[model samples]
Target: MARLSDQILTAIFSLQRHLLEGINETAATELAIFEQFGETEITIPALEQLQNARQRLTDPCSRL
Candidate 1:
């Protein structure tokens, strides 16, 4: 279960990073889809994992 969650989170955080790279119409639409899909279908456990991954990826400390 945890492994599955980790995989899902990895994929999601990758997309989330893409979303942050540049914001335009397409990205906005995709981000909206991400929000809906994540909130509705993604399991709570997976969401938590994704959030953690997102933070890690976006954190300045991770860059160094």
Candidate 2:
């Protein structure tokens, strides 16, 4: 049972990382689109936040 629980937790973490990667990609694409439309003021902060979130998601210590 403990082994199963560990497997479940590992799977959840894998899924979380996958989702975060998708979100990061989307954020990057959106930032580029925003730049093309001359919306730096709005997108800059959003991009920064996304970057911070991505960093936190990828950080090993965050899993604890």
Candidate 3:
């Protein structure tokens, strides 16, 4: 089995956190835009991914 390098692991974790935070913020912003303009179908289903990313980031060695 191949081992995960520390740099790769750290980069992956960092990306996860960044993506999670970005998605959560994006979702919130999308909702705001929808509400402000009375538009529909702007849901990106990002919140769930965001949560998953967060979980992955918080849980060490769970990538395997």
Which candidate ranks first by TM-score, i.e. highest? 3
- Candidate 1 displacement at residue 10 in angstroms: 25
Off by over 4 Å in 1: 1-42, 61-64
TM-score pick, better of 2 and 3: 3
- Candidate 2: tens digits of C-alpha lDDT, residues 1-64: 3356888889887887786776678667767767686557776777677677657656643453
Clashing residue pairs in candidate 2 are none
How does residue 36 of candidate 1 score in lDDT?
71
- Which candidate achieves the best lDDT against the true structure? 2
Candidate 2 TM-score versus the reference: 0.49
CA shift at 58, candidate 2, in angstroms?
Answer: 16
lDDT by candidate, in order shown: 0.56, 0.68, 0.60
Q: What is the TM-score of each candidate against the true structure?
A: 0.32, 0.49, 0.50
Q: What digit string (tens of lDDT, one per residue) describes model 3 on residues 1-64? A: 9999999989988877776666566556656655675543443344445456555544553442
Give Cα distance to truth, residue 39, candidate 1, Å.
5.2
